[model samples]
Target: MIKGIKGVKDILPEETPRWRLIEETARRWAVLYGFHEIRVPIFEVTALFARSIGASTDIVEKEMYTFQDRDGTSITLRPEGTAGTVRAYIEHNRAADPLPQKYFYTGPMFRHERPQAGRLRQFHQFGVESFGVADPRADVEVIALLWRMLSDLKLPSMTLEINNLGYAADREAYRPQLVAFLKQREETLCGNCRRRIDANPLRVLDCKVPQCRAATEAAPRLADCLSEQARAHFGSVLGELEAIGIPYSLNHRLVRGLDYYCLTTFEVTSTSLGAQNAVGAGGRYDALVETLGGPVTPAVGFAVGVERMAMMLPLAASSSESASVYVAGFGDRGSAAGFSALEELRLAGIRAVTDFRSGSLKSHLRQADRLRSQFALIIGDDEVVKGSAILRDMETKVQQEVFLTSLSSQVSSLLRIS
Candidate 1:
């Protein structure tokens, strides 16, 4: 038998409730925070990522899934969400329309990486981006949205770590000192770290390799190189987070993988996720808009790994079947009437399911039990002849006969769908 690809997962029927729960939670909070939904193409010109994510980063250099098209154009499946959102913001001339536009998107992202728990070649992310906002308050707002999604999900042992990557100029000043430190310990660093030292020195500090991490432990902190303005911006973000009572700690080592990020950066890590503890992360990027050929627009955003979040979900969230009703239609005329009732219930805003193929009332009830339906709308010949259907509480096995015409309204009332 043929099997699924490595590092790629199929979210099966049994597993979708958890995903819906996570996605729905994100959508509800995004709406509460004034973030509109935006959908972008899954793939874009490969240069878009390389230029925005940085050529030196692992995502651009080693992990991107780039393929040549028929016309020989290099296209890549998006490895992250922010770049595409910014591309749309510029290409659609949104810069001229408004200031501080916010958007949220949930979908798949591709990267070439080894398959492992909480990591995948084709994983999903629920991300939000806020554009054209330079205020530190915008940073705080985006961080609040991020915290809301994870906090409401009730994941345990989650910690919010914030940092100041400072501005690019600040990093430039800190670079020589950081590069000097890494160079002194060059022998202990990984190959990736050595290459990153010259190209993106800050990344060497961000490296997860044991040797690279230990080697840079005593390196000069970027916080020291932060400009006065950068310091104020980060200070405001921290003070506001405190004002809002969102728990957080300062972690100078919390650098994002992308190169566009600057100033305030943050991550939410859960002990439940093991070594790959980061469930979501993002930061402010003040220079990316101009870098991508648009007017300089400062933005802040975050991306949550949907798979990792799903893994952290409690078992109670695994099933979403309770809110629906099953229509068990047996026999010819009863089945026909049942089909009509199914549509009526659905049109009235009820979630209804059916198995007309069930040959007997016993079989139909069996199927409804298997579905874990809260209520079963049973229509057999006798009930059809009476112009009524049986509403059986699958859990209680208590049955009631209601006229077919009132089935939708009755079910709607019973399910409290109004």
Candidate 2:
């Protein structure tokens, strides 16, 4: 039999409550922050990512799932959300609507990478983007939104790390200094870091290799080279974060992997998730809108890996209260009556279920108990004949006889008390 591909796992029914909780909580907090929901396609032209995410980045060079369509046009399954969101922002002429357009999106993102505990070939992300907001307040507001959402989820041991990548001009001036430094340690640096020395030198600071990390320890710092405007923007963001009581640590080497990001890059890491600790991250991308052929627009946004966040979520509390009633029928007449009652209870906003197979009263009760059903409604031939049924409170082992006319209301009242 054919099976699901490696690295992509199914979200079984048993595990969906936690996913629902995360999505609901994210939507709730996003709305509170004035972010409206936006849905973008899962795939886009390959150039969108290569141009926006940067050609030298690992996402475009190694991780992207790129394929040639029937027309020989290069298409790719999106590995991230920002590029698609900005594309939609420009395509739909959203820039004309208002000064800043806020959008939040949640969906599966595809990448061809080795699967790890929290990382997957097909994963999900919750992202928010705001366009045309050039002020540092936009940066602070977006980070605050992420922090608030995580707090709402009750995640523990989270750390927010912030850094300034400086503007393009600052980076341009610092590039030669950084490259010259890395070149001196050419043999000591990792192969990836060596390649990036000339192509994208700043990414060397983000390298994970032990030797590279050690070699770059004394490398030039981007923060030291930040232009006055970049420094003021970052300083203002930190000031606002302090004003709002959101504590953050300054990480001098926190340049994000993407090339579009510039100034005020930040990441939230969770100690609970080992190795792949970054739960969410984003920064200012003031040049991306123009890069995508739209008018120059400044935007700030962040994305949290749903898989990673789900890992850190506490095991959901298990309560039998959700499934309120189980309908148990003994015989043909009893089955019909139980089925009808199930429908009636559901129509009245009661959570109800039934066993399709005819079984003994004892067997039905056992099934109800196994399902953790709050109450079991037993319908037998006698009950059908009498136009009433037995309601058994599973927790108390107490039974009551109720007429069919009052069954829905009685169940509702009983549930409220329980």
Top candidate by TM-score:
2
For every candidate, C-alpha RMSD to the true structure in Å? 3.1, 1.6
Off by over 4 Å in 1: 209-211, 322-354, 374-418
Best candidate, lDDT-wise?
A: 2
What's the number of clashes in each of the models? Answer: 0, 0
C-alpha TM-scores of all predictions:
0.88, 0.96
Which pairs of residues collide in model 2?
A: none
Q: Could you give candidate 1's per-residue lDDT for residues 186-297 as a string of tens digits?
A: 9999997788788878777778899887887889999988899999999999999999989999988888888899999999999989778999999999899999999988
Report the alpha-carbon TM-score of model 2 versus the true structure. Answer: 0.96
| Location of the lowest summed lDDT over 10 successive residues in candidate 1 | 314-323
Superposition error at 178 for model 1 (Å):
1.8
